[model samples]
Target: MTAGAGGRPGAAGRFASAVFGIAVLVFVLAPLLWLALRAFAGSWTYPHLLPSQWSLRWWSQVWDTPGLTSSIRLSLIITPIVTVLAMIVCLPAAYAIARYRFPGRQLVLMTIFATNAFPRFGLFITMASLFYSLNLMDRMAGVVIVQLIGTIVFMTWIPAAAFAAIPPSLEEAARDAGAGALRTFFTVTLPLAAPSILVAVILSFLAAFDEAQGTFLVGSPDIVTMPVQMYSLIGNYPDQVAAVFSIMLSIPSVLLLSLVRRRVLGGTIAQGFTIR
Candidate 1:
């Protein structure tokens, strides 16, 4: 805590901070580093710091495995469908809650909040029985619905806050210039809130992409997604193959998150989470 000539903190503080930051970074990344090593290693035995042999054999084997490819395909197909459907269903509700003051408005917001507040697995278990009665079990529609459940809070609440944050004057100005309600919304209000909504979309996309438990409960035997495949891989295959698949599962998340990293850091998404 030594001070500089101008009374600013000295080099000791900077050095300590730098060291702490580096240590935390290493701690966070160490698991991924181990996974990468495992994915490429031909043989990594006890007491070995590095592999005796390194090859792309696990990558090849992961692709060659039965059901793995289709699991990936199902994830690809289902994740986007869930994302789009969520946007379609939740955005209008978000807008209505943000702009209007109806009788049940507060109750609706509370209901949205309650969905995430409860034990989600319990809710999913309850839904599984209902899905069976409705004949939705083992269907793509059921999987999509299961994925959609977790996404509703993010899609609705975040965008609602984003919409609420926009100035009334912006929409009024658009309306004053001969724009209709729909035109003003499209031209001014929506565009102003687009960044936050985009963040919600990304979050919803990732939620569906990573969903496994409910998907397995409803769609197993007939629909096996990549995350669900991880269950079988860990029990039936070598560690390296599972590591390769784990890395594959993380790629889309890394890429999509990079797009909103700046806004996320700047609090665009954080502001939405505090919605009334």
Candidate 2:
């Protein structure tokens, strides 16, 4: 009749929580399930809870679509490039913000956050003319640069938080052991931050991989990426093609997440450090 000492939920409360969790899971997965079904459905019609038939014809069409191969290749090229460049640029900036108390540090972080708050379509549209005038339009370089604007903002914040969570004593101890600042960073700080940095790498890659607005504005037919190709396919083909494209788009992301599952789910940059 009495609640648990730790205030744990009663059986009815536990049942409610389980039901709520299941509902949330269904809410998230239902659309993906529907898309998977439609991707294989030969002729799904209204008023049917399931497909009348199933086949791989849509998948074959997806594979054979002109420019799809090139688009995928371009995405593979661009995503890594963007992720590496973003890490290079953001890591030091994030470290400085997290470790140092420089003037205007908060202001700089606020600006980065504000940049992400702008509507991406409007932001890309405004940059489109500037990119064109600079002769960067329709180029891979242009897409990478534009994509970096948003990705850097997002990627920077993640590592910044990770770095901030780290105890400064770890770096200080390394310094006490006769390590130079750079060596201390490379030896202690970076190792501790690796998990979060890996997370940032995966996220940066995904952001660049999935980016549509900036890529659409800056890239040409010659520089097509997967999202751009998918847009074209959806416009010219049936909805099934869109479903197929969604599955295709998701595969690499899913694989990347799987590869980093441990780090993403449980590991942290500074998980084991103690302040003593």
What value of lDDT does candidate 2 attain over all alpha carbons?
0.82
Per-residue error for 192 in candidate 2, Å, reads: 0.4
Per-model CA lDDT versus the true structure: 0.91, 0.82
lDDT of 1 by residue, 160-273 (tens): 998998888888888999999999989898888899899999999999999999998999888999999999899689999999999999999999899999988998767766
Candidate No. with top lDDT = 1
Per-residue alpha-carbon lDDT of candidate 2 for residues 1-276, written as tens digits (9 for 90 to 100): 343557978888788778888999999999999988889888888999998998889889877877787788888888888888998888999899889998998788887878778999998999989988998998889999987886786577778877887899989998998999999998888888877877878877888899987898788657789988877877688888889888999998899889778866674423312111
The TM-score values for the models, in the order shown, are 0.93, 0.87
The most accurate candidate by TM-score is: 1
RMSD score of candidate 1 (Å): 2.5
